[model samples]
Target chain A: MQYERPKSLMDAASLLAGAKGSAYALAGGTDLLVIMKNDDFDAELVVDIKSIEGLDEIRETSEAYTVGAAVSCAALGESTMLKEAWPGVVEAANLIGSTQIQGRCTVAGNLCNASPAADSVPALVAAGAKAIIVGPNGNRTIPVEEIPVAPGKTSLEKGEIVEAIQLDKRAPQSGDAYLRFIPRTEMDIAVVGVAVSLSLDDKGLVTSARVALGAVAPTVLLVEPAAEAIIGTKLDDAALERLADVCSAACQPIDDKRGTIEFRKKVSGVLARRAARIAFDRAGGK
Target chain B: MSAIAVSTTINGDEVEFLCQAEETLLDVLRERLGLTGAKEGCGTGDCGACSVMVDGRLVCACLVLGAEAEGRSIETIEGMANGDELHPLQTKFLEHAALQCGVCTPGFLVAAKALLDANPDPTEEEIRFWLAGNLCRCTGYDKIVRAVQDAAQELRGS
Candidate 1:
């Protein structure tokens, strides 16, 4: 095996473009090493991008908050602006594995891994996050919902890497929350996860909402009907139940050792209701 | 496959090596540098037996490549003592009987050092959460948790 450590993004791009045989971009290697050990990977070249400068930045601008691909989950949890503006993103990042796992796991790796049960996908989708993809052709922005085509698959072409995650600045009275159900307390993958973001009017009426679910489908799912069910309402128990029904209906779960299809479907609704309730409370609604 | 030359600071001393490109940090530490304090309980990141402090952050040495440590600082369990005097955590672990078979001691020591370095005073819940990655099949973790708590107080002098 050959390892290439690129000092800059351009250097990484050139190295990736020139490499032959099964080469992969190493972000944090939290998932890569596992895949390799399981005999599921066949790579002749491994490109290490950690030495590249300017790719670990977490910056906020007037338009969006840009989190570089190499930025660790610990860094995301520590960002006050990110926590204040989009707490759901922070919470999702915090829930990845454990403190030790979060120390090295990056958001880009989580998305690139493309697991249906990824904890951060639903939150990113709920916050209207966009992925800045860079390749030899140029850079292009794609919505988070469109980045993953299926479980363990992405839309990224060869030599392309995620540059940063860009989340639009939300409204003043908007808030987001993420909740996940896992068998164990820590270091366990999510069985069901839900993220909800709501924008409220001055009178505490929900103006707009976005609901996303994970671990219940081939890819992270955006249940638009679930969002619509809560919008234009005061988020009472009746509104929450209707939203839960929509979220449950949107799921296509499989029966695995972690959970049964029926259990995942039922818990999807439960998590959606819990997440929506938290989002509503954070949006300054009763 | 070509060898990669890396110069790094390990245990407060500068070290140079010519390592394989595919070698992990854990492999380099054990094979080349003869620092076997960080054990390879699992080649993957699921187990934290290979935990070490790299650039002041606790990371699994197994998940990081040797070439990635070209210009970084690392601290393993071997670095936890000073000229015949053990670190406070080491002392407390001995006093509190924190180990039994002792296969996972080094990883726990390094992880505890990281936790104390970041937060001088951590609550019980914080300790539990921080050390969740390091698994100990022996001792049931009751004594280990008590030892870490005792070590934190001893380090804090409170």
Candidate 2:
């Protein structure tokens, strides 16, 4: 195996495009290195993208925030501006692993790894995040939900790298929150995860909202019906109940050791209701 | 095997070594440079036994490639103490009898130091949460937590 730290996106793309065998783009290496160390792992090249200038930065602008692919979760937590703006995204990223893992893990990697239970994806999806992709062909931007096609696969083509994740500047009275259920308090994968992002009008009616569920399907799900249940309403008990029912109905979960199918379906509703309440409160709802 | 030459700073000393692309920093530290203070409890990042600080961020050495350490600074368990004198955390650990088997001591100490460096006054909940990644199989965590608390107080000089 060979390693190359390319300082340019084009160079990284070309390196991956030209590789004769399996090639991987290394962001944090928290997930990559684990698989690389496996006895049966076979990889011919690793292109480390950390050397690229500004790839580790969180660039904030008037319209949105551009989080570089190499930005660590720890760095995300440290960014007070990001935390204040998108607390759900920041908290979800911080909850990926322990402090040690957070120091090295990247949200871009989490998205690329395509784990249905990835703690950050549901929040990012609910926040309507976009992924900036750089490839040998050209650069393109796509919705975060479109990147993951299956349990362990991504929609990225050969030689394509996710350069950064872009989150839009939220409007006034906007808030988002992410919640996951695990048997343990920390350091365990989510049994069921839910994220809710909403914006309320002066009358406390939800102007816009998004609800995303993780660990209940092959990929993280954005339930429009669930979002619709709360839109134009003040998220009263009836509206929240409708939102929960929509979330529960949308789940296509499997029975695993972490949770039974019934349990996941039921808890998905519970968590969606709870997360929506938190997001509503954060948005200054009554 | 083709080996990559890397120049890095470890424990305030300039060091250079040859390592493969896939060799982890923990492997390079323990096998090449003879810095075995960072043990490999689990080659995966779950076990914090290989915890170390790279460029001031605490991470598992087992998850970082040695070739990626070029021009980076690392702090390991070997650097926790200054010369013959033990650090406050170390002294407190000894005073609190924080070890039954010594394998996890280095990791716990390194992780604790990182916590103290970031937050001088950590609550018990914070301490427990911070040290959750570093598992002590001997179940000596209560003493370890006490040692860290004592060390924090002593370091603060209150």
Q: Which candidate has the top score in TM-score? A: 2
lDDT winner: 2
lDDT string for model 1 (B50-151, tens) is 889888888889888888888999989988899899999999889989999888899999999989988989999999888888889998889999999999
- Per-chain TM-score of chain A in candidate 2 equals 0.99
Over 4 Å off, model 1 = none
Expressed as tens digits, the lDDT of each residue in A234-263 for candidate 2 is 999999999999999999999998999999
Q: Please, what is the whole-model Cα lDDT of each candidate in the order they appear?
A: 0.88, 0.95
Task: Give the winner by DockQ.
Answer: 2
TM-score result, candidate 2: 0.99
Q: Compared with the true structure, what per-residue lDDT tens digits does model 1 show for residues A1-286? A: 7888788777777677777787788887788767766655677888878777877889888888999998889888889999999999899988998666787889988999999999999999999899998888888999988889998889988788888899899898899999999987788899999999999999899999999999999999999999899999998889989988999999999999899999999999999999999998887887
* Cα lDDT over the full model 1: 0.88
Off by over 4 Å in 2: none
Clashing residue pair totals per candidate (backbone < 3 A): 0, 0
> TM-score for chain A of every candidate model?
0.98, 0.99
Q: What is the model-wide C-alpha lDDT for candidate 2?
A: 0.95
